[model samples]
Target: MYALVDCNHFFVSCERLFRPDLRNHPVCVLSNNDGCVVSLSHEAKILGIKRGVPLFQIADIVKKNNIAIFSSNYLLYSGISERVMKIITDTAKNVDVYSIDEAFIDLRNYEKKELVPLMRLLAEKIKKWVGIPVSIGVAPTKTLAKVAAHYAKKYKGYKQVCCIDDEQKRVKALSTFDIADVWGIGRQFSKKLTSFGVNTAYDFTQKKEFWVQKHFTIMGVRAWKELQGIPTINTTEINRKQSICTSRSFGATVTDIESLKESIAHFTAMSAQKLRKQNSIANIISVFILTDRFSKQEEHYYHTRSMALPVGTNDTAELILYAHQLLTELYKRGKAYKKSGVILSGIVPNSSVQQNMFDNLKNREKRSLLNKVVDNINSKSGLNSVKYAAQISTDKKWTTKTSFKSPDYLTNINELFEVH
Candidate 1:
């Protein structure tokens, strides 16, 4: 059996972990630069604050309702996530950290009754020790465990741990859950499934494997089997990431070319770091810029340009130079830009890349050494200890607005609080 453990209102919950006073209070975590509502607590959701609602639009509502808002503090979240995963790993024989706030653990050895009490103890321990509340769902497969975890979070009687070990209970849970709420069934598939009268998890599971495979591909077939309590998804780690793109909305809309260039350079540097961390190199670099889609002016503009590298690389300087070239080509004088991003595609492990003989490439050894040195220095210090020229003196205006961000109590000594 697999057990999926998911933290409740992860980002908001991370904040509440330190400030227990925020428990049961309406709270939300905003996207970088405090752009919008990215994570909301149940109480905040109850007050009709929908995810992705712009910060400005909800300011009055949040103030009137006394909603606690926070800027995204990834440092705190990452440390807490590590602690949570450590707790899970120490408790379970086999565990996969699926996300920042979720993990799938193999629980085939435990009986239903034994698992329930153990899970309750586990949840309480994590809450008391790690300061994060998690809901665990136990079933024969990862997909079912995910559904079980969702039900556990939604229902109070489950005691934050729901086990679907019995055939009858599994079927009952599947029958009650909407098909769209299933882990793998997205909106378009849900609509198509609904058209075929497969509106619930039970209905989807009832469909023949042949029909599901024909319409939905291998993943759908696997999900269907999983819904029927047949384990198809493996708990083993999948190392390959399909794509990696880094983008951010500005703290405020930017119109100046210099500021836009700096933002693109900064994002490119970040993307390069990620690529290097994964030990991957991209063959193509894609740059995109756009004005606010909701602007009243009929001038809704977006441009994307993809450039093939002479040779694949994870070097920050080379990537930023190429990105700047693309930015210069795409940025028109009169255009008002709100957001920009860079996508590195055709990514392959650095070890797998075949170097070109004829192309006049930059010194690979020097670039790699410089990148490593820079990364080490930055990691020892903070971001921007070393940065590209384009990023220098660029107004901090391009940063995300995080005026209400909570402290990084775990990482930032200066931000730590002490109370008598």
Candidate 2:
């Protein structure tokens, strides 16, 4: 059996953790630059506030309803997610982290009678310990477990845990589950399924296997089989991201090369930190800059440059130097650039990084050790505590707007929450 654990209203829950008064109120968390609604509380949803709607579009409603709003605080969210996942991992040793707020537990070894009770206890423990409510769903397959999770989160009658251990329960759940809400079935497939008069999970399962295989290929077949109480989806213990890109739109447009360089330098350093965290290195570095597409004051400009490194590296200094070089080639004077980013690709495991025959091995080892020490310090302190000189600039035009961001209570010592 597979049990899926999903955090309920994760971002809003994190915000409510420090601000207990937010409970029973309409609350929401905005996306980058306070662009759109990303997470919302139950009260906000009850008010018909949809996720991903532009904040400006709902300005009147927000003011009328007195909804509590917050800017995206990724640092705080990640810290709380780590604590929640840690408790889960400690309890369910065999676990697959599907996303920041979700994990799958393998229960093949446990007896059928113990499945629901075990996960119910886990849900209670997580709520009491982390102050974040979770929904756990158990079934014979991962896809089915996702369906059960939906019901567990939707109706409070389940007590935050649901299990589909028999054919009868599975059929009843699948009958009402929307095809679009099923795992692996995105909007595009849902539209196609609805066109064929297949509107529910059970309707999808009624399709012939050959027809599904012919239309959707292996991925669709996997979802189809998994929905029919067959375990076909394979979850690896560690899945390395294919590429990492760090970029952001500035709070205000930048025109100078120095300011853009500082932004790129900061982005490169962040990307390098992520690469080192995954024990991987990149062979390709790409830099891109853009002007405001909607700005009538200047011609829209978007250009990117990519270069192959002599050797794959996760060293921050090397990445920043290369990123700066790319930016120099791509930057056009007086463009009024609005955004910039650094991308690292062709990533490979650190152990598989082949050394150049004429490389300076000694210097490489020294740089590697330097990165480790710097990372150690930054991890103990806050990010960018030991940043390179290139990342520091007197001009702050490139910084993004975070007018409503909450405190970093878990990660930053200076921003710790105080109890009065």
Candidate 3:
């Protein structure tokens, strides 16, 4: 059996973990730069505050309804997600994280345990420990498990855990479910399916092999089979990401090569850290710097460069040097770059990296050790406790405006939530 566990209004719930008074209140969490609503509580939905609605458009409504708004705090969300997943992992025998806010728990070992009751217990444990609510959907396959989760969320009778162990229940669940809302069917597929009179999840499974193949190829066929309670998709295994990128729009535009170098260096350092975290090494480093497209006075320009490393590495210093070289090659005299970022690709597991016998790169062991030390210091003392000299001295500066961001309560000691 497969069980999908999904957090309810993940971002809003993360904020409400600390602010208990906000429970059952109209609350919405915004996207980057607090631009649009990304997550909203059930109470907020009742007030007709839709997700993705721009904050400016809803200003009057927020004021009239006394809605509580918050900036997207990824640091807080990640911390809370970790704590919530720990509780889930402790309950289930095997698990696969589907997303930051959802995970699939393998329930093969727990046949002896009363399934729905056990799931309810797990849900309650997570709520009690993490101060966040979760809905669990159990079924014969991963796709159906996800459908069960959706049903559990929409209605209150499931008690936060919905199980579809019988074919009759499965049919009923799929009959009412829109084809578009199925796990793998995206917007494009939904439109095509709708045109073909496939309105419900059940309607999709009724299509011929030729029709499914022509529309979605093998992938849609997999979704079709999974809906029929046959597990075509492998839920137990995990696939490594093909590439990892770390880039952000600056709080302010930059004008000089030295400052752009600083931003790219920091981004490179961050990308390297991510590579090391995933036990991966990258052979290609790509950098891009762009000017504000909205600026009427300044001519628009986007500069991008990619170079293969002499040897694949997850070392921050090596990546910073490569990033600096790329920026030097791409930087113009006075472009007024608004955004810059670094992308590391051609990633392979660190252990799988084969050394080039003809190429001689020295001090690799020492560099790895130094990078590990810096990562450790930042992890323990807080990020940016230690940084490269180039990063420390760059006169070019940019800062994010996160006035409404909550404290990193779980990750940083000084920012820990306190009882007054």
Looking at candidate 1, what is the lDDT of residue 148?
91
Model 1, 241-318: lDDT tens digits are: 546799988878888888888888889998898788678899999999998889897488899998999898888888
lDDT of 3 by residue, 327-411 (tens): 8899888777778999999998888777877656677888888989998887665567799887775354654446578888877
Identify the candidate with maximal lDDT.
2
Off by over 4 Å in 1: 32-35, 54-61, 107-121, 234-239, 294-298, 359-394
Candidate 2: which stretches are off by over 4 Å?
Answer: 360-362
RMSD (CA, Å), candidate 3 to true, equals: 2.5
Best of the candidates, TM-score: 2
lDDT of 1 at 34: 78
Q: What is candidate 2's lDDT per residue for 233-318, written digit by digit as tens?
A: 87652347679999999989999999999999999999999899889999999999999999988778999999999889999999
Query: What is the Å distance of residue 205 in model 3 from its true position?
Result: 1.0
The lDDT of model 2 is 0.91
Q: Which is better, 1 or 3, measured by lDDT?
A: 3
Clashing pairs in 2: none
Ranking by lDDT: 2, 3, 1
RMSD of each: 3.1, 2.0, 2.5
Better of 1 and 2 by lDDT: 2
**Which pairs in model 1 have colliding backbones?**
33-400, 33-401, 71-405
